[model samples]
Target: MLSGRFRLLRREEPERANAAIGLDIEVFDAWTGQARAAGTLSGGEGFCAALALALGLSETVQAHAGARRIDTLLIDEGFGSLDEEALEMAMEVLAGLEAGNRLVGVISHVAELKARIPARLEVTPGLRGSTARFVIA
Candidate 1:
């Protein structure tokens, strides 16, 4: 998921924390060229880093493959951690991807994200199970 300072990693090693699905990663360290506790990151920084990495990896794969051909990118809830500036930056990145055919899906409970990113699927929990409704707005 694209996040700024959400719990992307374990408490002890935040910098090393990664999405379980394995995407490209780029993190902005407060202390350059060094490692620190994962909890130390401000929300925006962490999310920016992760998003950058993911984007970079996608670019690399497309370059080698000679075409853009990823079916979709699904991100679970994690965007709320960012500040306004960070949120804008993240949105900018998402927006720029529109030129390609890849479908980028971000799953978030944060209302701001729901409003900012168009084309979404909402999941609601019920007594027996959960139901999802797809929306393109």
Candidate 2:
């Protein structure tokens, strides 16, 4: 769930903001004005942007429906594409959204991200099939 309006404005181009839906998000190439090739975002930029858009849409929906509040967001396994700086920025954005009962869960295998977000629920193979356990730092 999201609170208020989530707007993603390019630092330079404020007029070209695009709307995004829950897991369905769009990634635009500012230079070519076209969508990137499918599964071609090498540097986490696509994932980060898509996440931002989803957040925006969720917020919009909540406000339009007059919901009082909502909490939690889940992101799974995509941090490998980002560089250190971009990763840091993404982490900051997620961390900064602590207000309004927002809880962001990033599911990632990257060691850096695992170390950064110390609390997590890990799932692993067990005697039968798999087991899940929460790890908190």
Say what the RMSD of model 2 is.
7.6
Task: Give a tens-digit lDDT track for model 1, residues 1-137.
Answer: 33333323323333345635232223334336544454465665656666765776777897899796766776665588887777787777777676566677787788887777667778999999999998777
TM-score of each: 0.65, 0.66
Q: Local distance difference test, per candidate?
A: 0.64, 0.66
Model 1 regions lying over 4 Å from their true place: 1-40, 66-68
Model 1 per-residue lDDT at 55: 75
lDDT of 2 at 2: 17
| Ten-residue stretch with the least lDDT total in model 2 | 1-10
Clashing pairs in 1: 3-47, 4-43, 4-47, 5-43, 14-38, 24-53
lDDT of 2: 0.66
Candidate 2 clashing pairs? 44-81
